[model samples]
Target: MKHIAHFFLFVALQILLMDSLVLYSTGFCFIYVAFLLFLPLGISRVWLLVLGFIVGFTVDIFYDTMGIHAAASVLLAFLRPLVLNLLTPRDGYDSGDAVNIHTMGWRWFLAYTFTLVIVHHTAVFFLETISFQTALYTMVKILLSTLFTALVMVILQLLFFSSKRERMDYR
Candidate 1:
């Protein structure tokens, strides 16, 4: 139920709002990827891939970029587990843990989000260009966009989600 609402919210946000936002003509905030990034850590890889494709396909429909978004999103989904494994702490994630700033702490969340966002942006920018002619420009776009997207995601998480630590501290 919550996921359904989030799906619509993110897709609408991307199509209606974020699609027009371009920072300095180089940074693009693809906040839709936040949907995939914040999914429960215990979710299956197959579901992640399916959801990634669905979200990307939905965005592609609006952007009219054919399937470039889908391809990049699928790649992100495919790489998510590997990134999680690499970042796993010695104690491992709890059974009910979520991939969010609140649950994982700021450092781990930033690392996880940056790693995945960079990969996604690289695929997106490179696939869109499909040539090395503008390799430098593409790299700039990738880095700036990654930073922009990660920043927006972090802000959104802080604004909407509260952690156990926050709740306990409030008392």
Candidate 2:
């Protein structure tokens, strides 16, 4: 139920709002990726890939970009678990753990988001460009957009999500 609402919210936000926002004509914020990034930690990889495709396809429909978003998003989904493993804490994630700032701590969340965002943006820009003619420009766009998207995601998480208190299981 909550995921459904987030799907619509992120798609609408990306298409209606973030689509038009371009900073310095280089930085474009694709806040829609936040939907995929913040999914519950215990979700299956297949579901993550499916959801990533669905969200990216929805955005591609609006943007008319011929599936670039979908490809990049699928790549992001594929890379997510690897990133999570690399960043896993000493005790590892609890079953109910989430990928938000509140649950994962700011450092972990930032590292996770930034790493994924850069990979996603690289795929997006490079696939869209399909040439080395503007390699530098594309790299700039990837970095700047990654920064912009990560910043917006962090701010949104901070503003909207409350800390998740530990749950006690009483037999």
Candidate 3:
């Protein structure tokens, strides 16, 4: 339920808001990737895959890119649990904790999100570009865009999400 709502909101934001963000020919990034980063750790793989497909397809519709973003987002979703396990905290996670500064601590969450975001962006850019002739430039764009988007995601997490062990709600 929550995941479905989140997926829709992120896709809508990516379609509408991502385009308005511009900077230095690479200063902007669409933040829909945050959905994967912030999702609950225990969500089923099938749910994650579906979330990825929906988010991707929605962006595909908006971008007219023939589901490229959907494919990339699915790739990101597939990689998410691997990254999470690799970065799992020793203290253990609460059942409904949001994977952000609040739950994972700022340092751990930053490292985790940054690493995953880079991977996601790398996959997205290279796949979208699909050629090494312009790989250098495309890599630069991916890095800058990843930085911008990751920064936005971190800020938004800190600002919007409150991981209360008491109530256990994202809102």
Candidate 4:
């Protein structure tokens, strides 16, 4: 229930707000991937992929970018488990622990977020352009857009999802 709401919230924010921030004419910030990143660790991959497709399709409907967002999102979902395995701690991830800054810490969160965002942006830009004549331009777009999106995601986590100050009670 809660995640469903968040899914819609991120979709709304991405389409309504972040989609308008065109940087360098070839780059655009996409913060909606944050929703996919924050899904619970124990969710089945099938559900994850389905949810990714749905979310990406929803975003595509608003952004009018055909299936680009859906394809990128599906790729991200496919890669998520691999990324999580590569970055798993010595004890492994708890079922309830989300892949967010509060649970994973800053360093792990940044690496995870940056890698996934870069992969997503690379897929989106290259697929959307589909030509080697503009390979250099596409590369620039991927890098810059990945950086901007990562920065925004981190900032948002810091501002809205920080868990450091949560009040605890001692009886």
Candidate 5:
């Protein structure tokens, strides 16, 4: 239920605001990929792919770019577990541990977010470009956009999300 709410919230933010965010008319940040990053760790792969598609498709509808967003998002979702496996802590995670920065700590979350966002942005820009004629341009756009998106995602998490333990620390 909470995931559903977040899905909609991200979709709305992407379609309503982020779509119009054009840096230098070439670099564009797609912050919606953060939605896929923060999904509960134990969710089934099938549902993750489906939800990724739904979020991307919804954003595509508004952005008017057809299925590029859908493709990138699905790829990001598919690659998430692989990233987690590579970066998992030696002690492993508790079942209740989430993928958010507050749960995973800033260092782990930064690595996780950077890896996935690069993959996601690469897919989006390459697919959208679909030509080597401007490959250099596309690569530049992907790099800049990934940095911009990742920075925004980190700031948002730090500002809005308090870990269960942190909330308790307030008392």
Candidate 6:
């Protein structure tokens, strides 16, 4: 519930400011899909889907893009646990800890976030494009946008969260 609220707040900010940001030619998409990546490790699968739907639906409402955000977000939510399973050791994750660079480590979090971001961006762009006539350009745009978004997710996580605090909480 707390996570969902934070995501909604950030999505609101993104909707209001998305027009002001750009990367090269592509726009910077700093959304709360990062929250999807950070869901508690022990959460139920049903809550996972529900939270993804909430965030994605909220983005859809703000951006007026229909189901694109919903599909991409749900996909990311579904993939997150798998990525964590692969990246973190069997006992590495805990339900109480936040999923940030500080808690998950930079390499693990980056790889996890990047993979999900690329997957999400690909689905979103292709859904919006709904065509592959210029597949190369579309691919480039998706890659670039994903890269920028991933950076934003990481930087935000690092800035907002620090390892020392997480260590105290875990202890």
Task: Give the winner by lDDT.
Answer: 2
lDDT of 5 at 2: 65
Best by TM-score: 2
Reference-based TM-score of each model: 0.94, 0.95, 0.89, 0.92, 0.92, 0.88
Candidate 1 structure quality by residue, lDDT tens digits, 134-164: 9999999999999999999999999997776
lDDT of 2: 0.90
Per-model CA lDDT versus the true structure: 0.88, 0.90, 0.78, 0.85, 0.83, 0.77
Residue 56 lDDT (model 2):
92
RMSD (CA, Å), each prediction: 4.2, 2.6, 2.7, 4.1, 4.0, 2.9
Q: For residues 68-156, write the lDDT of model 2, one tens digit per residue.
A: 99999999999999999999999998755667788779899999999999999999999999999999999999999999999999899
Task: Spell out the clash pairs found in candidate 3.
Answer: 56-70
- Report the lDDT tens digits of candidate 4 across residue range 1-171: 767888988998898888778887866888889889888777789998998899889988987899999999999999998999999988887666666687678889888998899999998888899898999989999988998999898888878775853322222
Better of 3 and 5 by lDDT: 5
- Candidate order by decreasing lDDT: 2, 1, 4, 5, 3, 6
Kindly indicate the candidate among 3 and 5 with the higher TM-score.
Answer: 5
Worst 10 residues of 5 by lDDT: 162-171
**TM-score of predicted structure 2:** 0.95
lDDT of 5: 0.83
